[model samples]
Target: MRLAPVRDDVAGFDAGEAAAFDPQPVRDAGGSGERITSLTSWWHTRWCQVCGHTFRRGDRVLVADSRVRHLDPTLDCAESGGGRADEAEVVRFTEGLLATWPVVGDVPLTRTDDVPGLLAPPLGGLRRAACLFCAHTFRPGEFVVMCPCTPAARVCARAVHRDPARGLPCWESWRPGSTLKVCPVTLTRLAT
Candidate 1:
């Protein structure tokens, strides 16, 4: 459907007068990695090779070397397509991995000029056969891994989800009038 052209006299157009225009309030997802006036964020959707789970824009997930593919169709780890590994197989991959390497969550990546290759697209590309969720950035003759993670471990994804109880889009930049930061779960109970 075509919308009426907006007028420069928007200030004079009150609610009833603008009804024919079908105006929509501006939205700021804030977490969509938009490059606003002065700030920019980097967040992208990725798939979990181990569980075949597709993570959304801001989810935190584990990553491992892509050379090793995990998660068979039956939810078991496998070195290759034909062979299956049991629960212990996952332990082999995820166990001491965290003890030695810290878990890296999905955070926005910004370009840095100081790092020789940080601003360049990952050398092998974001999806590489040898890398899980990310590719590689090289300096001179060496390969440098980007912000890293491992799929062998699980990180809770609840924080990445929008508030389920309120079912409202993000309002970090919106202030219709007055707002409160009350718990929606409690508000639901009080309503009934």
Candidate 2:
């Protein structure tokens, strides 16, 4: 989708120092094996692939070079008149797939960087919640991850600290063992 970082001071991708980032292990994860550069947004908005929400200004996002193509009646259905059927099949499959993923009730912070804006304080319409991993209330601008577990396995769709750099490695601590990588709450297998 060609999204740039949402910083007012930065003019474009070249203006900011780009770094390599591993793609989040999500469904249909897109990104070439090559090192990808993150761009700063001067002007433009994009929908978060993980949450499907609009990206606010000043939000730092990691974007991959990928495009989702929709089948067109003339280009695809013309060959077999299967556009409608194909579209319906795609929709049904998507719905079924999404049903299997984590069911966080609120709009989730897709990346650690988005926590500042999405989880801002009351003066900024704060979202009051606690981290499932450590049981501590989340402070504004803290890096966190909304528990990406199935509804039955989640403890109120909690948010947990994800940034290890600042000494809060709650997310990394949640799933301690390498045994199938299940959620700690109910041992339910995580989608990603």
Candidate 3:
């Protein structure tokens, strides 16, 4: 079996000293951390698979395995090697490392109001969206109702002005006396 060079370690070893070195490949977070060394022979020098340079006495070189050859050419030691053999398996390995990665930047707070229960604008502000009924922009602090017509799979219709006193009579004009209250965005029939 070809040992996977999962451990990202670099070590230097003399010609005969590598025979004594016994390194282990990284399996998971709890894996034994060992440095992988590229051997330099007294009789002849070995060429690097990545940079095409001859391995000198103490050059830091990354060693690849059968698994590494399947990785992207930019990352792998083999220049022509490309495409992931198992993207899901690669994700599984990195997911553990990603857990330890530091969290950067604060998440923006959701904006809330008394009228809409639990439903709030994303990132403390409403994205500028026009009302399909009146062709008017839904401004901030405006009382608007999202069309309940859309299914869970599809994107919901644009918000219409609910409070006619504060804004344009969009909701009133859209609903009453219409044979079909189809959502302008999704073109789906409104749930009456």
Q: After superposition, how far is residue 14 of candidate 3 from its true place, in Å?
A: 99
Query: lDDT score, residue 20, model 3?
Result: 57
Q: How many residue pairs clash (N, CA or C atoms closer than 3 angstroms) in each of the candidate models, in the order given?
A: 5, 5, 0
TM of each candidate vs. truth:
0.18, 0.28, 0.28
What would the per-residue lDDT of candidate 1 be over residues 1-192, giving only the tens digit for each residue? 433445534545676587658856444344322222211212233334444333333333222332222223332334433333475655454434434533233322211233343333323335212222222111111122222221122121111111111121122112122132432323322111
Ranking by TM-score: 3, 2, 1
- List the RMSD of every prediction in angstroms: 20.8, 18.4, 25.3
Give a tens-digit lDDT track for model 2, residues 1-192.
534545534655434444324333324234522212223332123433333333333333343355221122322211222223465565465445445543234423334345453343334343334566665445433566665454334353556665443345665576443122576556777565
Instruction: Note the Cα lDDT for every prediction shown.
Output: 0.29, 0.42, 0.39
Q: What ranking emerges by lDDT with the best candidate at the front?
A: 2, 3, 1
Q: In candidate 1, where is summed lDDT lowest over 10 consecutive residues?
A: 156-165
Task: Identify the runs in model 1 with alpha carbons over 4 angstroms from their true place.
Answer: 1-71, 75-82, 103-192
- Candidate 2: worst-modelled 10 consecutive residues by lDDT: 69-78
The local lDDT score (0 to 100) that residue 93 gets in candidate 3 is 47
